[model samples]
Target: MAAPNDVQISIPKNDIEEQGFKDFDYSQRAQWLRAAVLGANDGLVTIASLMIGIGAVNEDARAMVLTGFAGLVAGACSMAIGEFVSVYSQLEIEVAQMKREKRVGERGEKEEEREKEQLPNPMQAAMASALAFSLGAMVPLLAAAFIVDHKVRLGVVVGAVSLALVVFGWVGAVLGGTHVVRSCARVLVGGWMAMAITFGLTKLIGSSGMQL
Candidate 1:
């Protein structure tokens, strides 16, 4: 019944749909990359730092190697446990929050959908978070295992660990929807404090003729 000029117009929806799909793909890839970086960086830095501080005081190759081995086992296990606990705790809290949010969401679908939060199973989230954390804390230690000189290796580990923590903390903060500057500063400050304490203890013990 419409005139020729009033003919129905059809728009191609594929372009938009395709673009959205690509964007989602890219986002997922980016998140994976970020998690990888975090895990590797943490592993490299923490273990290295621990080795460096220990090596600084004990110059013996045997001792260094032993310490490094111990560090590797301790760090990896600690990372796994800590990450599991932390992630599990967070998952519990987030699940509770989302449950409450779900009720609110049901009350107002439009508003809730507009502010819809994605809450997955606690076990899943916890497992993922813990895995990421443990992996992050494992890299530098592994690197140190291959290095030869105890002292030099230790120093390398310290530097690498500090750098790694800074990078990981900053990146993590960004992912967590927080301020990178604050997270970075927090990590850096803690590193400096730890170094100071380690060295100070060494000095105090040396003066007292007691080896720490």
Candidate 2:
């Protein structure tokens, strides 16, 4: 027997390799990032288009401001509820899969492990989506709130939203390791198209002597 002071240490053959193990892939964050980006894009486009549409016919600052506020509240709530429900559904599917996996395991230990990682947190995903949407919607709201001039306010809001869309697109692209310019251009074009369509429709309706 060895003396009490004497110590023996044994290291596994794969210790060095295990120590160097790293999962640099961002796949785990893909779902949450996609939700966040989509939420923000929806918020920006929807609210901005609504504001522009209202502003095209109604020159009253109060009307535009009120419409924008209502849109923000409604959009945010809708986004939150929608995200929660959608993510919860996905969570249920994962739970079902886990249960199935367990049943499979009970049949025999020789069965290979199927699910390697834990399921995503639906609550976390929902919250992130809602928060991102609210943040995005605030850009146009703030622009309309500060400027009293109707035409100038419209222009400012459009510009601000466009800039925000570009920034958001770039951020998403960077996070997802995509082409920044392509993403930015795509978002910019989509935003402008939404605004243009809304503005044109409202203008046509107003010119047709429709009381709104």
Candidate 2: worst-modelled 10 consecutive residues by lDDT: 107-116
Measured with C-alpha atoms, the lDDT of residue 73 in candidate 2 is 82
Backbone clash count, each prediction separately:
12, 0
Q: Write the per-residue lDDT of candidate 2 for residues 20-122, one digit (tens) a residue.
A: 5444466767878988998899889888999899999998877887888788788878887888888889878977977887877654443334455656777
Q: Give residue 121's lDDT in candidate 1 (0 to 100).
A: 39
Most TM-score-accurate candidate: 2
Give the 10-residue window scoring lowest on summed lDDT in candidate 1.
25-34
- Cα lDDT tens digits, model 1, 70-155, are 65566555654655565567667876765787777665675466345443333443344446555654545554667776656666
Q: Model 1 Cα displacement at 202 (Å)?
A: 4.0
True-structure RMSD for candidate 1? 7.3
Model 2: CA > 4 A from native: 1-23, 106-116
Predict model 2's lDDT versus the native.
0.85
